[model samples]
Target chain A: MTVDHEPVSTADGGEPRFSTWTGKARGWALRRLPPDKLLPEGQPSYVSSWIYVFGMGAVAALVYIIGSGIVLALNGPTWFHVSSLGRFINSTHLWSVELFFMFMVIHLWGKFWMAAWRGGRVLTWITGMLAFVVSIVTAFTGYLLQTNFDSQWIAFQAKDALNAVGIGAWFNVADLGQILMWHITLLPLAVAVVVALHVVLVRMHGVVPPLEAAASDAQLSSATPNPATESEHRK
Target chain B: MLGIQQTDAGMPDPGIYFQWGDFLIQFGNLVVIATMVVLFILALVIPFPGRRSRK
Candidate 1:
């Protein structure tokens, strides 16, 4: 018996098919470049407050940390142990991380207190918080990758505690090489993915208003009675 | 997290290993841990009146 087979089209075919990165898609990506900067033209009128600075400040610190980290990586971990320039860069990177965590913690608190998660924004808040938690783990691993005396001591200490807690098999903090790869690759990628999702959610939901106004509006509408008032009351 | 053994083999002697760096590291660690504790307490204790209003 003879079997018939369908022919597959190739480049030689008369008509050309465009790739996913075609003009329209490329334009869409470009228009959405720097996801966090989507509101460059204007933020919502309700986005006023010094509290908002913490989020931007955290991003700035992350930028500095990544840039300085790249320089340190180029120098190699051992360079910081022997070279003055490398040491300075390492110190700067360390301070940048400290500031990054500090700002992120404050930003998280501010968001929580403001109840910024309201109005269909819970996902953004949760994603950003998860990103923060992942960044902390990444930082911890990076510290282990330093391969200095401090790194060695911290690794042994942390390994002991983690082993006691029964998670030692999954994460070997003493594996400097593996930890370095995770710090430079996996962690950063995870952080980037979560941050992208966070920005998308924020844009879709828009910035939440201050609690006072939102509450007053809720009370005012709730005090009145009607289907429209009920909807407004539910706000 | 890694291998766990009760033996103290390869562990540096705490008595002979004291240094300014170790002191600084310990002090810094304590400070960070303390700050986090305080912040966590404040987060829970402080009345989030604003959030109630917003809702």
Candidate 2:
């Protein structure tokens, strides 16, 4: 048998080799960093503002809610009703949820008025808004799972409203077992999937540049035109 | 089966009567809804700073 020892080279005379696991892992880590950290594409000097903090605050609230919720789930619903630790976990989850919604809504609205959807970022904004709506419904289902007298009344009332809106047939609010399953399983899964998609979209498009800075610079300008100027022109 | 047994447990069962759980659920729901509405209104009311013209 003849032993062939030929070096692999590309048409351009460069060495031809597949990326190793280390190379791929390094690329992944680099891609995961925030825009300010990873890339040389510097943020505009005008990017500093209190308005920028709400999005991060919303993310923090989401972290708290998910962590507390997991603890509550591990203890089980019945334990939440009986055990002190479980009750505290449940309450923490509840408060975290409240905070999450508060911050999320503020972030969403701020982004809207700031025209943060410019620069081909509409899809990200839309996905995030859908996630917000889904989260609200999930929270509603969670309340019903408490299996308290409050849950019973809210179930009846909410069922009536849902029936009036023509969706009650699909989701029986009165069934504690059903509500619990949806809360701990279906709804959270949906939220997680939507959130993943939202984050991926955000990463792909990158954060929307501050309106003033982007309109002035117009460097890596996207298809979506400056919203402020367009609105002004309309006026 | 559970539902059938629960139904057989009677209308005036102590669990169903004077149920604090039901009251709490109602209260919680009301408070959450009210808070969401108030926040939404506040969001609409708050005027965001105008973007400076890019000269």
Off by over 4 Å in 2: A1-44, A218-235, B1-55
- As a whole number from 0 to 100, the lDDT of residue A102 in candidate 2 is 73
lDDT per prediction? 0.69, 0.68
Give candidate 1 regions above 4 Å deviation: A1-37, A164-167, A215-235, B1-55
Model 1: per-residue Cα lDDT over B1-55, one tens digit each: 2322233335442222213432423335556667855765664455544443442
TM-scores for every candidate against the unseen true structure: 0.63, 0.63
Prediction 2 global C-alpha lDDT? 0.68
> What DockQ values do the models have?
0.06, 0.08
TM-score of 2: 0.63
Over A44-121, each residue of candidate 1 has an lDDT whose tens digit, in order, gives: 434444556667787789889889888877888679767898889989998988888877887788788879887667
